[model samples]
Target: MKIQAKSLVDTVAERLEEAIIGGELAPGERVFEQVLAADYGISRGPLREAIRRLEGRRLLERTANKGVRVVDLSPERLEELLQVRESLEGMAARLAAGQIGDDEVGELRKLLETHQETSLEKGYYQQSGDFDFHFRIVQASGNGFLISLLTEDLYDLLRLYRYKSSTMVGRAEQALAEHHAIVDALAAHDPDAAEAAMRTHISNARTHARMALERAEAEAASTAEG
Candidate 1:
């Protein structure tokens, strides 16, 4: 019974994060604990625990009035985060190039093939599987601190922005090509090339994200005026 309840908390937390990433839960939206708990068909006790976990992840923040809101970093703040991401992920690629084993490189190749097939089926963008590519490389880096910082500290938040950017026209194919380049660099064990390729990929993603956000804001403004 205790284990089941714990499982329920984990399930709830996972779904909530998915909702946020999928844009079902808008950035800065207020969360209604009772309603959300009811929606999940769970008691408030478990739901509160789940929410607390997300809050700890820096995804949710609590207010003085017991209100919970998604963390909505402004454009400038998001840019700052992306800049840091650019550097860290580049470093990860460089390290991975230096140390990644043949088996792991082969596994990454398999992942890309899987991703390509997935893309063909879905017009080239699968939201659920998108984060897997970078994650595998970061793990291959073998740097515990970089792994912890990127995966634990910044993964989901960065995913949020990337999700927004990924839907842009032509971005899917472009990103896939970029992924291929990074993988090629890693396969060749060229640290300089790997770092350069990864940095370029991240930089391009930041540009796409900025454009997507601006379009969304403009659409919202138009709707408001109408």
Candidate 2:
């Protein structure tokens, strides 16, 4: 394994993040440095750095003697995470209403259009990472403290649950409609409306997530019975 990319560490971190989110690296799966380095075609040096970064993000956990594995979040923890997200992201939308530029508002509109296409044609929800509505709104908020808390501290965990939870029956279209409501409030520069819409959207997401989890549990139970 050799490093050719300029920022090999960052590249590897991002790829690993994607793999975890995409379920290529399943939750709680043990990670082996030697195998992963060979698989990713990067040296253990940079790959180790990437793993450490993810550890900081709480995406991976290291155990004494047991070694490192992807963080496997329990249902209770995921609910707690969503509670924090609802508070912080609601504040972000409120702040963004005051601070967002006209250009950024247009960017939000265009991003919605892209999401609309994907939702309609491809039959999925929003994009992850930079193209995400939540990501853009947090950027628009222009508050470094909130930005760091949401993006650096909790972004990956949030995204993982968001992607997983969104598969609830008929949730994709509803979530897109919620996004439109949120963007409308932001575009109007109404702090109250923006915060309300964002909070509502997050609350709805939490509900859908619970429903999805319950459905999965029921299906698993039925399979076991059979």
Candidate 3:
């Protein structure tokens, strides 16, 4: 009975995490336990447990009287998160340049080729393709701690923010060019160049996100005054 209960809780948590990361559950949106419990046909016990797990994952937050809400992706928080990513992903790229096998390099090149083709055809970079490229590099870094930090701890939140940021005008093509530079450094097995490229890419992403947020806020203020 206990084992079954745990399984149900895990299921609920995974579903909720997907919903949040997929943008079905918008950031700062409150989660209603009763409605969710009823929708999933689960009791509040397991549902509450699932919410608690998401809290641990940093996907949800609970206040004294406000209940659980999805973590808000404000501009300030976005900058902080991107700064951390710049440092971590830069290190990952540097290590990967030294540690990646020839086959992995080939795979990365193929993926970039696909990205270029798709972007040219679709007029934007595919978000999944971008994620795949970053994920592959981090995995090839051969640093277990870095892998876990990126894949396990940060990926869900990263997906959420990436989805939001990808909407910025002209960002897709710019990001593709930056990705090409990173791939070039990796192909040459130059750790310093790889790290520099990764840092610059993430820094540019941060700036784009900030500018988008500022534009959104300005639009909102203009609407209010109008």
Task: Identify the runs in model 3 with alpha carbons over 4 angstroms from their true place.
Answer: 1-15, 38-46, 114-131, 219-226
Q: Compare the candidates by TM-score and give the number of the best one.
A: 1
State each model's C-alpha RMSD to the native: 3.2, 2.9, 4.5
Q: Indicate whether candidate 1 or candidate 3 has the larger TM-score.
A: 1
lDDT of 1 at 195: 100
Summed over model 1, clashes come to: 0
Q: Rate the local accuracy (lDDT) of all candidates.
A: 0.84, 0.85, 0.82
Q: What stretches of model 1 exceed 4 Å from their correct place?
A: 1-6, 120-131
Tens-digit per-residue lDDT, 1-226, candidate 3:
1123458988899788778866678779999999888788778998999899999879999999998999987988998888889999999999999978788888888887887777544434335324477888889899999999987798766666665666688888888888889988998999999999999988888887778677767886899999
Shift in Å, residue 129, candidate 3: 11
Candidate number of the best lDDT: 2
lDDT of 2: 0.85
**lDDT score, candidate 3:** 0.82
- Which 10 consecutive positions of candidate 1 have the poorest summed lDDT? 121-130
Itemize residue pairs with steric clashes in candidate 1.
none
TM-score of each: 0.91, 0.86, 0.80
